[model samples]
Target: MSIQLNHTIVAARDKETSAKFLSGVLGVPVGPRFGPFVPVEMSNGVTLDFIDTGGEPITAQHYAFLVSENEFDAIFGRIREAGMAYYADPHHAQPQQINHRDGGRGVYFDDPNGHNLEILTRPYGSGPP
Candidate 1:
């Protein structure tokens, strides 16, 4: 049998808040709680299980999602409507702008937990870089 990513633990100050935030942004439902974790499953069947940090220092992590053009538009619109700051680059060099990389649109933004979240219409390295 082939191995695949099933789930990952995401450290958050509040599991419910983080799970809800991600679910809302991705337009997906937050999964039922399992023990101390509040899960949000992606379309690929991988789950991001949010758990409280319990006073532990949380380090930022980057997560990138490849979405369709329509999904990107809907998600980006939610980002804008929420008044969240977004950058065209991962380093945040370009403010309030989206990048046209790999011949598709992409944007980087920070989640409430300070995790770097990226959404793009095309997969990186799929075309001319």
Candidate 2:
């Protein structure tokens, strides 16, 4: 059996706001509801289940995405336009710059729920320049 990620639960103070924010940034629509989860499907067949926490403070979680260069540019533009800081590293030291890790470009930022969001063009520690 080949193992693949099915979905992940994203805790949000408000599912509607979080779903809308993610849908806007990712350029996708949040469609249909399933039980307590607001299912947001991606083009890649992955779903992010947004769970409402009713203003309860949530611990920050890290989520990384592998996107094309053009997608990176567009997402970066959206991040900057939203007035949020982007970093080359998870520590947010090199703000507004992409990192040259694994011989590919990578950037890091956070979502409204304080979830660390990362975009990279290559897999971690793999591939050539």
Candidate 3:
């Protein structure tokens, strides 16, 4: 069988809160708890299993999501409504702007755990520059 990413553990101070935050942003439901994990499953069947770190410092990680235009709108709306700061580029040089890279919209924001989250309507290099 081809190798696929089935699940990954997302370290958070509060697993439930982190899971709910991600679910609300993505407009998807968080799955029922399994042991120490509160899972948030993506459309591709890959799960982001949130685990409590019990006050441990979380090393920020970057997660990029390729979403449709409609999905991007909805998710971006939520981001703005939450007053979350976003940037057009990954380096965060351009504030309050979205990038039209590869002929699609893209933005980068940080999660509660300080993880860099990116949402783009197109895959990089998939279209004309």
Candidate 4:
């Protein structure tokens, strides 16, 4: 069988909260708990499994999602509706804006657990410069 990513573990202070937060922002439903994970299946069939960190200091990680143009608009609307801070760049130097990278709209924001989250309409290097 071809190698594929089925799932990934995401550390969070509370798995349920993190999973719900992600699913809500992406406009997807949270899947049933499997073992210790609260799964959020992506459109690509890969799942982000959220697990609780038990209050330890959590190291943040960056997670990126490639979305359709319409999905980008809806997700961005939810982001702003929540009064969240977003940036055009991952480094966050450009705030309150989105980037036209790869000739498509993109933005960066942080989850409740401080993990860097990104949504882009085009894959890097997949479109005109």
Residues 65-105, candidate 3: write the lDDT tens digits: 99999999999999999999999988899999999998999
Residue pairs in clash, model 1: none
TM-score of each: 0.96, 0.90, 0.95, 0.96
Candidate 2 ranges beyond 4 A from true positions: none
Model 1: per-residue Cα lDDT over 1-129, one tens digit each: 899999999999999999999899889899999999999999999999999999899999998988999999999999999999999999999999999988999999998889999999999878854
How well does candidate 4 match the true structure in TM-score terms? 0.96
- Please report the candidate that would top lDDT against the real structure: 4
Residue 54, candidate 3: Cα error in Å is 1.4
For all candidates in order, the CA lDDT equals: 0.93, 0.86, 0.94, 0.96
Candidate 2: pairs in clash: none
Candidate 4's C-alpha lDDT? 0.96
Runs in model 3 deviating more than 4 A are none
Better of 3 and 4 by lDDT: 4
| Per-residue lDDT over 82-113 for candidate 4, one digit per residue giving the tens place of the 0 to 100 score | 99999999999999999998899999999999
